[model samples]
Target chain A: MRFSVLGVGTSFVESAMAETHGFADCDMNSQLLSPRLRRRMSSATRLALTAGERACADANVDVSSVPSVFASIAGEIKVTDTLCRNIAGRDFPLSPTQFHNSVHNTAAGYWSMVTKNKHAAQALGAGENTWVMGLLESCCQLRSLTDKVLLICYEEAAPEPLVMGEQISDCAVAMLLGIPSDKKRSVCIYQQRVEHAGASTELWSPVSAALALAKAVRHPQNSSKLPISSTAHGWYAEVVHGE
Target chain B: MKQLSQSIPITAYSAVTACGLGNTPLYMALESGKNCLQPLELFHIDIPTCVGEVREVLPEISESLRRFDTRNARLALATLNCEKGSVRHAVMHAIEQYGADRIGVVIGTSTSGMYETELAYEYFRDKQHMPESFDFLNQHAWGATADYLKYELGLSGPAYAISTACSSSSKAIASAQRLIASGVCDAVLAGGVDSLCRLTLYGFSSLELLSEKPCTPLDKNRQGINLGEGGALLLLEKPDSQHADRPHLLGCGESSDAYHMTAPHPDGLGAQQAMHIALTQAGLSTKEIDYVNLHATGTVMNDASEMKAIKAIFQSGVKCSGTKGITGHTLGAAGAIESIISLLALECGMMPGTAGLTEADTAFQYDVMGASETTASVRTVMSNNFGFGGNNASLIFGQYADNG
Candidate 1:
């Protein structure tokens, strides 16, 4: 089995539910979303689409042909807060737009809907291992149905008081997978199970799957296997090592 | 396509709805031809619209689930209670009976813990204070419901939440069947659950899709949709000698319209693709489908487009019905809940009527069964769910053990 990392896109952190800043700004991590649409959407939707679009652009792949898999641990927490409040208030009414945006896959759904890509798309949420699971599912789907897949993993900043002092970072990463061609940049997904992280928790944290993946693609190590801790519980980390 | 044979099948099933609990009651009510919809009374529904609110109440959580006060937690715990215990308990029984660690749990939900998290934020806003009980990891994420199930049940294999709006839970079951077929999980617990929240009401109202009176799916005089909430659970196992009683999850197809963010393509192109995919994957032509559980929510765009999609896919005289008229569109849980209804149809070999559907929108071509049961072989059935942002999924299920 052969696959390659085709393209990648990302989003810098934005405050909860705030409009994403323009991509050209020094922080170029985020992209501007139309005010008309942003007013009706949640931050999670904005961040996911922004990063997804960039990744598609990087891979030079048309969004229409590429199947997409969105992996998010926590999606649209701010919307969750608002919906919960309305329910508890008993007299408060729910917003239709907010309700639509509140759905978990709204981010990925928006990406597909906006891009007008009728291809396969899915939104998956797991625990810490969400990124890893997302990668695995993306690979499996790509291998099963089509020749290529675009996997976008993102975590939006949770609304205040929701994180409960949990050290959370807002990050988004996209990877394009397909049968590797000699002329194209490629990587092979090597699956393995390891017991522990070699370094400190801060450096070897499970959420660092993105960093490891980025590093593996950026600087290919001699070893063909990379070990990762599970982002979700009880699951082992997998390494995608290639030359 | 490698001549895809040996499709997945739905075996055993159960559900809870505003109509009532259990297959027998729901089936009885559907057969009685009485509308189960009522005003949104579960939470002081401030929006003043009708809802298919499941007849449930705040539950007394077990010592194990006391900390999970989010709406998803409440629904999960209540659903488990309805089934007798935690998912682990249920799966253990299936495993002991069926004999396999290859068991998997796939669930679909939309609001999830948002209802609880909103309450926590409201605590800070209304009382001008925050609560210590508010845990972000537990209540505010999309995966909270699935994660809670995994933890509570100790499910070690593949587990995740499918968040495709109304079609979510249904997709979970479909995906579980794929994994099981691919030899990922043996037996699977598949379904979806969601609770009512004010945000949903106000949100739909803003879109002008909410109805003041009961929704009428195919009625020319239809006003709008009446949103509802509930949960359904089904136990799916790979057919074997030990398990001769369950239904089989035949096949499934998923597609996105990518046409509009909120509004479905006027032509129902995405919906057409979804239905087509399911039919093709099941390796059955349109003629083979005994009945269809349409995603007819009564909204003008959704109904018209879905009808168009249905007409384009099925033959001129294919039998189909929209049960949402009885259940009141369960949003993310619709797919899973409706699948149970489809399974029920296969179990009894009777098709439930399209409740509240008075006038067949003459524009639709297929035979729309309303307010009655249509008895047929029901060897193959298709269920459709289209979500916001163009996400659409279709599942096909066949009667279990059809050697006779």
Candidate 2:
């Protein structure tokens, strides 16, 4: 089964660095989100919900109606750092809210809470290949279980002073993937084995690969083969546009 | 889309926990009904809560894969190389049956290298930067454990990590089943690994969900959860002519509570939906399940909601119990560890009971086994794991006949 890109919600990605060989800026919509909940949200959760709301709105589907799959490289890196610092100090005064938000699915959980979406949701991490793996997972669900699935890939900026702080930046990309029904941009993905990951030297987040997919959705007339990001084990995705 | 009924056979499975190194130790502890939880020693905690530490000395990761070293990787490596484990043999066999490229790795973990990162942060406290030894990509990333498994096993087909809090591994198994069903992977090594770290211990403590002693999951006097560390792996493959006597993963149903960030729905509406969906997908009635391994964490709200959901579905009174009282709450690995327990119940025809449950909660009418049942004829089992995001997943397993 191929996925028809029903909607593409990508905002706040550094496309100059994320684009494959050639990618591109974001439009985040937050009017639907509650300000109280949004204020307390971690960066990852905020970005995911922003993109998720946009994707659902673009697809003309209620956010609560569809199951979601969230992908990330390092989820809530800042929150993790804060909690780590707290524990190392033996403060014993850690915030319960911070502890609850430390889960890798922080974004997925918050999205569910705000939208009241009880549909099955998943959060995943695959290092560099997180974007494609999320796609693989979403594809599996669309093929066997659900007709439509919301896939969101997000990453918060790495904690400062750490080496990763320089390599990683904030980015969130969401796609509403469904079975081929409309004339929307449809793509079929297959796995490929490699000696080294495609973007190994850059340590690219799934944001780049997802940004490339977002670019594809915008200009489907290009109809060129797109190479998604690769995993640490040299696993990558080869996306073929469905006519 | 109830394709979960396709029946994916578990070719082989193994688990390493505070109980011991392999399935034997886990089963023995269950049969002996020993409380494996002990005084917290892995890390210094001000609280008096107990912890389930893998007392066994873990093997060191190979030098080639040294960069991916962490307690979580150690836990996963212990399972991978356990002497009594069937994974080493089964994975090699799968490589021969299906090219190494056809077999996938789907591992679940909540905090993959968070403990190591915590230590690295301590280094940052003094050095201004993390130690030169700290490798973020290999050591601290959430997918590190899964990559370590893929590299160690030398198998590569769509590998990734699922980290949906407590339901991580069960969801990983469910995804593996779908991968095989989707024809992308012929066989998949699926399970989860989680190590006790200050993050979860202190994290749960901050929530006031940590019990000062051994946790009683379904008892009226139940306090809270005792953090634990361990991992379990089950190799699931498309059914073949062989291994029919083995237990097969029949169906998986997943849902979100959408009620709150940390608390479950008041009546466990999502939990009930997950159970109903799983039963419908498996094409079985509540009475068909021989037993249930609840996601009972020994917390007041969690236990009540889960029990209410259970009663709503299994009103006829199917056998049920919580095993976390023995192993403590393994967090991300809870799903896989408990799944192995359920599979063991089906294969060994023995039901492991709630270890810390001294007295059953008076509110719930269904009996939560307080002692292991040595004599039982079990044909099917249901395992439930609910996590922080209100993520609820239920898995059904049963024996499948082989074509000789």
Candidate 3:
């Protein structure tokens, strides 16, 4: 029920984390991917890799050795919309690269290739509860395997037609969690059971869960509880920062 | 790397493919060595290709679930409706034993209601406006299938969708096992469903990975894959003393190739690792395996790499076949569909042969089933499903024994 948060990474609004001491720019550079692969990656993939690499660097862990779970609300909308447009045009041939990168796990696959991480990589989608579910899956992995898990959650703005008046944005967050040790500045994540109720109205957006979790991590307080997100069974996450 | 202390049971499962609407027809086709692939007819494409389209006239969704209707969801509903609604029966039973909140749903899908989006786009192009009936929230969402299934079944547990391409469903099964093992849930509905669409058809064709003829895995003249569509679901539960007769999900091994975006490793290192890991976790040696359902999509690289991995693992005695020659590659649903086929092999004591394979490739030293079904006393079987992102997964299923 307890784990250490060794590192944290975020790529939300530009310059939001720039003022923090340990935080770096949220920009996704071409350092982790080749030019060709970088060009082929969608915005979601870039955000995920950027946050994952930064977390690994911040934690002083090798990216290739860790198992990872990537979560997203909407995956590769740009590529999907483009493909739909091409199909509507009765186009004989669609772009092969776009099709390959269109899968929801494209970013996870690209991360593996970039870091040569052969361990298990999982990609999941759960409407607004993606971040919490990703954390839950990672915690389960850590408990079962006795190893650190890299959890990354990202969301890309859906196209205009798909968004249909909803306000979606681009953001990514990554965390390294494992059994708490004597390591410096490690926060404990506690998973608790709560009563079933309607989803909370506080910052109810796809990216809000990760943003809230990041805020708590950056500015630690005494046992501050943050509501991650609610699931069908009213299962949600609340992080407890250790003193 | 730790092994599961107890085995999980696959209490119920159903599959709908071009071979047939239910498990019986699929099993019959495998027994008779029938190939159900025909020229692609579900959609219009300028290229000549073949696909394993579900020929059964799918039943329309009920009025209440009309908003969730799509080719993908309909295929899923049809597959779930198979075995006389065995999945529903199993779920309801689980709800009685474990609270509805104690059951979880994990489904895998690559394209969920994408065909509807394509249609809406077409309508927009012609009419200069989107159709009023188009429901993007219900149809275009990647988590639509899982949400719909959860709503239909009225299960209030953790539900999500895994979208790791072809390995999606296989990983979904693995994730469900984790949920049970972690004590987060007592039972889970785990599987995958993907319906054929113009996006996939034209996409594969553009990649030059689509074959005009039926795919011939391990054949000397194997060219490429023949894409197909279908749905497969499995109800996995934590086994106790009472559930002794259910088929056991022995173990699941997952690994990323980290080699390429689409192409597999030439030496099949990741595939071998997955098989080795699965065997280790199952506490069984390679000699104990009786059959293997290969991820051979018939593409030159895919078949060759998979053969290397299979040869390295089982060597000679184990029987292996790629049913994609019959079912075609079902994309994200391939893992679950093939797992169901593996379970069928265990139950029926019949090893399905590669449907379209004529001349076996001489480069590999493994037993690849040909057009004839191999009747053996199958005990332990393995199914491999590797996907576009170099994502690889292998699952081991064993015949349930009362003495265990």
Tens-place lDDT digits, model 2, residues B1-404: 53544778998889999999999889998887787999977777777899989988899999988988999999998998885557978999999989888998999898898888888888888777887778888888888899899888987777889999999999999999999988779999999999988888888888999999888899999999998889999999887868676788888899999888889997889899989988887888888888899999999999999999999999989888898888989999999999999989988989988887889999987788888896557888899999998999999988663210
Model 1: per-residue Cα lDDT over B28-121, one tens digit each: 8777666777886655645668888777574654576555557666666566656444444657776676453356666788777666655666
Instruction: Please give the lDDT score for candidate 3.
Output: 0.82
| Leading candidate by lDDT | 2
User: How close to the true structure is residue A32 of candidate 2, measured as C-alpha lDDT?
Assistant: 54
**DockQ of each model vs. true complex:** 0.46, 0.73, 0.67
TM-scores for chain B, in order? 0.92, 0.97, 0.97
True contacts recovered per prediction: 0.62, 0.80, 0.70
| Candidate 3 lDDT score at position B388 | 83
lDDT of 2: 0.84
lDDT per residue for candidate 2 within A1-243, as digits (tens), equals 468888878655344644432424453436557778767877678778888888888899988899999998888888888888887677776899999998998888888888889999999888877888899899889878998999998887876744463444576889999986545567777655566543355576577678777777777666466667644444333335445
Local distance difference test values of all predictions, in order: 0.69, 0.84, 0.82
Which lDDT value does model 3 have at A59?
86
Worst 10-residue lDDT window for candidate 3 chain B reads B395-404
Question: Where does model 2 exceed 4 Å of error?
Answer: A13-29, A161-168, A195-199, A231-243, B401-404
Off by over 4 Å in 1: A1-4, A14-43, A79-96, A164-168, A179-207, A222-243, B1-6, B57-59, B81-90, B93-101, B239-245, B374-376, B401-404
